[model samples]
Target: MATDTTTTAPARPPGTVSWWRRPWIAPLAIVTAVFLATALPRYVGLDPARSLVPTDRGPAFYPALVTHIFTGSVMLSAAVLQLWPWLRAHHPRVHRWSGRVYVASAIPTSIAALVVAQFPSGGVAQQVANTFLGVLLLTFTLLGYRAVRQRRFADHREWMVRSTALAFSIVTNRFWSTVLIAAYAPGALTDPDIGFGSPEIEGAAVASAWVSWIVNLMFAEWWIHRKPKRRSRVR
Candidate 1:
């Protein structure tokens, strides 16, 4: 009668909850991937005069622009993969390889960004905004790399998350700039002083640059600190 003494434990859920698995993250990643895919290649294909960079930019600008876009395109494309939880969980080797690519790409991208920031197309506010972003991108990325070296996984994750958000700010900044332009477009097109390309657009660009990373980082921090939902226990 002692043969039926053993009991089976219940199966646990398949995986842990993680911010990377948030529903919104994938869609946003897809959209940004698409945008960078279209936009970056166009610039990469174009000569300096026809590219996004100003025609009269310095000698350093061309090389810097190329480096920024090439590395940025690689970084951004790989970035989407980095946030995919399934990849991290099921294919950790791939995740680690992708992280290496990301960190390597960030090195040249951040350096190029800093170089280009010094010769901003917009005014003082734009310069300041871009410089802050460039420095932050470089600093945070290095910190993340250092954390990984130290085996501080949590710190690495946080710093790298911040770095990624800063990089992605380029997308958010452009989106915000477009929104601001659309808000003012009707008036801007009508007014002789503010038509098409003008200081008003530049002003919006400055504001967008500052707000994008700042807001994204703030949101990232909130997301990182958010309490995990407790799964119900079953007997």
Candidate 2:
């Protein structure tokens, strides 16, 4: 009798990271670059106009926003490092310390975002959408940290990926605006600049804010599940 001796590799667990996921990948790297390029110059310096918020925002607004920006920068940088597979595989101690920094900083940063969302220059809809985004950021980050504490690495990765998606929604929002502002800016771009339709731009901006996080999370879910389970046959 002939017996089969070939062994099959175990399947990747469902609802987790994709095989292609990595920090330096084009998609993530480009987004992170855009964010840092646009954000650092505006917020890193100690100027109020840098915030781009309406001047009418109370004195407290600038300080709160600055705090949020600084903390968020820390969280974002740490999260990017945490996503590095080489560091996780070869230097786990560094990964753990960075993960702690990401979670601790992200929580307070999300809270600050919620505070700033109350005075949305894009109007009430943007305010509401951004508030929701902050909530999601806080929730996802905490859950991710908790999962790792419980020794559920798969769940930790999934949640952290989702949280990173939401964190990067600011970049997604800009992408949406770049596409949308074209249609919204016809009048503003014209020489006479009549019928600029400020309301239309506001509506489009609000839509971008909502779609930013929602769409990012949707894509994250797809990426996280892209690694599917293999099925077995019984003889």
Candidate 3:
């Protein structure tokens, strides 16, 4: 009898593409674009609170501005840490601390969204859309936490991914707003004349938020179920 031996090659680590290796790049780019398009002009140079005041609407504008700034800051910080592997495992304590901070910031930001959505300046359409957003955020957040408490790692990961994707509406909303404005009118991007329910802007924000979360959940489901389905098919 003759013995034959062949060594198998090491398997490559799983991921989408080379670009995803630097996950921080994509998120940072998104944050920068969103800030420039929405938040920066309002807070950095101008008095955002006063500017956001809905002269004919009500007092929801200022509160909304405050919430935007606070939430944007938290998101920017958290987005950086979301690239944890890139940090080279230098400080586990810092990562944990930042996670706690992200959770804390998310709670109030989500609540403020719910309150402001009730009295949206754009009127009933915006109110309805934002109300859905607020409820979705709260639901996903609670579900994520519950999964963790029960030690269901996969469930926790899925829920957290969904929650984070919803939170990223800040970025997606701005992206959609820019696209709509450009496609509709040349100077409509920051036009005060174009309010939330205006034909050019109406539904874009809410749609963006909904699409973001839906896509994320779909991706998570695919990841979780793909291998099992493949195995079943093979059998």
lDDT of 2 by residue, 7-65 (tens): 77665443234546543555666678678777878877778875654545776677778
Clashes of each: 0, 0, 0
In the range 1-235, model 1's lDDT, one tens digit per residue, is 5587666667643334465657876797778878887678657665776576464668888788788888988888778888877678778899999999999999899999888888776777878888888899999999999999999999999998999889898878777877776674646645657642476776666777788889988988887888988766544
**Model 1: worst 10 consecutive residues (lDDT sum):** 12-21
Q: Rank the candidates by lDDT, best first.
A: 1, 2, 3
- Ten contiguous residues minimizing lDDT sum, candidate 2: 188-197
lDDT of 3 by residue, 1-235 (tens): 9776756555434332356655566666576566656655566554544554342345665556567566756855674564455331556677656655666677777787777777664457667766777777768778877886798968976776667666766656666656645775545565767665565554454454455445655665575566642312211
Return the top candidate by TM-score.
1
Clashing pairs in 3: none
Residue 19 CA error for candidate 2 (Å)?
11
Cα-based lDDT at residue 115, candidate 1: 85
For candidate 2, give the lDDT of residue 105.
93
Off by over 4 Å in 3: 1-41, 44-56, 87-92, 182-235
**Stretches of candidate 1 above 4 Å error?**
1-21, 188-197
Relative to the unseen true structure, what is the C-alpha lDDT of residue 92 in candidate 1, on a scale of 0 to 100? 87
In Å, residue 68's CA in model 3 sits off its true spot by: 4.1
